[model samples]
Target chain A: MTTPPLAETILSFLKKINPHQPLPTAEQNLFELALLSSSDFITLIQLLEEESGILLDFTQIDPAALASMQGLLAAFSAAETGSKL
Target chain B: MDHYPWLSPPDHTAQALRMDHHLWHYGQLMTHAELLSRAIDWSIAGPLRLLAILGNQDPWVYPAMLAAHRLGGGFLPLHPAFPSERLQHMLHQCQTRLLLVTSDGLATLDQLLPNLSDSMLCIITEDTKGNRPLLFPQHRFLDSTDLQQLPARPAHPAPNTQAAYVMFTSGSTGRAKGVAVSFANLHAYVRYWQTHHPIGPGDRVAQPADITFDLSIHPIFVSWASGALLCPIPPATRFAPARFILEQQLTVWVSVPSVAMMMERLNILRPALFPTIRLSLFCGEPLPTRTAEAWRQSTPQGRLLNLYGPTEATVAISAFEWQAESAQQEPPGNVPIGWTFPEQQAALLQEDGSLLLSAGTGDLCLAGSQVTGGYLADPDKSAAHYFYHPDSGATLWYRTGDWVQRREDGCLLFLNRVDQQIKRHGYRIELHEIEHVLRARVGHDWVAVIPWPGGTQPVRALVACVAAEENSPTADWLQHCRQHLPSYMVPSRIMVVPQLPLNHNGKINRAALQQLVQATLFPTEAT
Candidate 1:
């Protein structure tokens, strides 16, 4: 079985958290739309780690990286590729 | 001995405080305060209070507080993170003429220049070069360099009846209400602490609260009066509170329960992590049983205390010493608020204005030395909450708005706020009770219960926002709640979030949670 893309996994998790609200596009601002809080950001990181098999240190990651869907995908991609964020 | 205990001579050498790398001795604090007081007298012509917008744990803040008191003027401490509009409102509310700002607060003041009055005076503590232009040309600017050159004067005493400080609390009316605490009230609180929980020389008290919060008053005044060292935790280290306590070897730990919740979230609360802390206190919000247990394990040698009070009450007017065995005997969510202070009287009043002596739930009313005079310059607001007690020789009682049940043992167990009580299906439900049940089941201390479809609806759903560890399923939490709570009391929806939102005061922001529930669960409804 093939794995889903990073953006797909993030969008899926966002939908699970708030099924009533419209799902955000990859470039949409999750934080600005009130779809994410500090706690929700932590949960998103955990979900991304599970889906991508990349362990990210919550303390080391900048909170700005979780502000938007694009930022979330970038953070996940950086962790997966072992590159600096 | 000076009438003001804070200005009196220390019992030992002046090593009174340590803020990170900086060490402030008693003599240095008094000398700087004297110099700052003289500068204020020279620069400002009229009677005015000095409002400080500095870091809570800044070394200059304590002296600024003393200087203001010495000049017979009140000191208002404001959080720098507050929006310029709110800051402007506070400045206007207090009629602040002189503002004491640290070099860090200069940028914030610059942004607020448009909102500040032209007659305002700015005193910058770290501006030695004196290069920064005044935010307003009419605004007078003084720097630390100028204050050091001013000749020191003898300590001028403020009247005991004078207002010591003015703190702004968010009012239910969407505006900030200024609470003016008098010197007599503070003195009474200090005397109460001295008589009950006495701190002596060599004690290191932790200052973890924001300078604007009333919780900060406990460590600041108690440490200064006892000649003990006030160790202020830096903002960067606040998240890792257990590590900060261990590194500082803080003898007395005083902070909101949120710090412990954060420590628990980060898995930092190891057994015996804070062995040096002799007195551990949690206040500003409800103390969950699990958080209390984790804290007790960390500070095995320390005495765990839960204090209760609003800003209207000076610091904390009541306290409960948590005992391990007794805590286990009580219900899972119940943490007794314990006994009122010696000078204060606590009563539970029913809806019909009759007092409930024992074994009943009602509004908790407090009357005594710890209560403030009233809200700043707003008698209407003050009259709404405070009233004269005809039975107690006309003593004013502050209606706390907190609904608490007086147990037969004379201890008070806090229920939800009277405002938070929702009537659904012809049944009145306390939202905090549902939150308590959820917290007990989820093993998480950070949980909030807000009314869903929130408005003037007679029947509303209860939405439970639980801060769970990663990968925890919401269905299991819902099942757990169903098992524990009755049909009417169980929450309609159990939402699993990573953390609960906090407002400026560090308490659970119910308004923000209600907004989140509305946006996510009821998006079609008007917020």
Candidate 2:
């Protein structure tokens, strides 16, 4: 999946499970805080893999990889190419 | 004298709740005090035997507790998931004169009333819709109004040292022991925990485990002591509990590692769910390293603490916070229990009785006010477990049969239990505990119990019984067990064997039986 698509998928999965949170966006801001949480990030990754067929290893994804929507997109690209984007 | 209600006076009401619409507003919970006061009034005159049907994550537990106190009657909280027989055994064992069932929970008692009618009094907590209350012809149903009309005249306090609650602990002897934790021990425990950990008004706590499991004390007493809102969560949703945590904004989270693993599987770690989870406490079993790592990774800002203790030690003896940096420094799966709680005094004692305070692994010895006086109605077992220290004549310590090693950092890491006790999926299981219940119900002389957890998440039991019995063990055992043990402790499969394998010493070799289970070749292998 493309970077924007991966971010959108994760954002949507988080939205589905916990509707209490204001809707997350593909843009980088407070949405980055969701990736910092292990439970939310794992949920995002699992949904991303199931929906978009992109494999994200929790250990491999660094802070910068989840810093912004563009950065998350790039990380997906790196994961697709089997290297750090 | 210390107050009978040992809780510190409540202050900072804003700290009373974190998440909104979770259970009740502070004002609503206060209204329960009057309701609870009325319920307590009814119980003061006679022995009120109450069986608390605990499963629904209702915040109404506090009021039920207040009512239980007012009646001068002790509570027998049973897991709703417990099979009919186990529930019956609990009701009979407690000599439960009164039962408190929720309106939605009336159907569970239908099958086991015959066995329970002698001592059981069925009391419904809420009203059912269309179903008229059927009289078992012998059982009495107490309604919500009956709860409200509880007499106001006060009675003497129930014996604090007597068995207030008796839940089964798993053992190797194939029988579950009813670990009777007294009100004094529970009271002392919460008091000690409060002095050290200190909870207050605004703290919202989650009751995640089934109440039958002793670990549920975290939500129960912690909330009561601090006047914090106690939000009970269903056991089914324990795995994906982050949803509730997020929805409710709970500040305190209590659960077992297996439940934590389930949470990881369900993916509830988004920031929205865990923003307020400051105190993430794990007990009932060791926090698996992978699970701990997941928690550390997920809630980087949250404080992860691990508590270790048996029901015999009240609720917990020692605790350690999972320092993210420290855990990251160590290899995977090497998480250590960090330290003892401030109020608790613990020491590792060798089999020879010499204190292993400096180094080495031994049975964890617990000493403090929180140590229960003794087991109920089982003096022999209690004498064998509670020992007086030789050096100090007055200092008594309870031998916690659990094996653990003291780390260089002063934290203790739990090894295997010395006896045949196993902590499966956060339940302290004694194989013999199940066997005892089985024998009591089935009248069987020869029975060998072993856990078979090769595939299923819950550690199901494989029972080997005398093959010559006219009635072979089957699903009926499940019904029989439901009367005595909690639902999780029941054996899933029973295999009747002509004879059990005995070693050269002529004792039943559990390892051999476990091997048979592991190979999936007990009486027969699956297709």
Best by DockQ: 1
| Candidate 2 chain B lDDT trough over 10 residues, lowest sum | B39-48
Chain B TM-score per candidate, please.
Answer: 0.78, 0.79
**lDDT, candidate 1, B1-527, per-residue tens:** 32244733355365788986888788778766776676665234223354455545467888888888766766888666665666777777776667788756766777876666546667778846254464367677778787777676666566767678878765544356788788888989989888888877778999875677778888988888888899987654453455456666789998777567655654567788778888988877677787788888888889999998887888788888887785668777646788888989888887788766677899999988889878876788899888876566777889888888888888888876777655443233557666766777778679888876555322345778888766676666765665544444566566767788998999999888888888877675453
Docking class of 2: incorrect
Q: For this target, which candidate reaches the highest TM-score against the unseen true structure?
A: 1
Which docking category, incorrect, acceptable, medium or high, applies to candidate 1? incorrect
Measured against the true structure, the TM-scores of the candidates, in listed sequence, are 0.73, 0.71
Model 2, position B180, has a per-residue lDDT of 64
lDDT of 2 by residue, B428-450 (tens): 77767777777776676577677
Worst 10 residues of 2 chain A by lDDT: A30-39
Task: Give the TM-score (vs. native) of candidate 2.
Answer: 0.71
Error of 1 at B398 (Å): 0.5
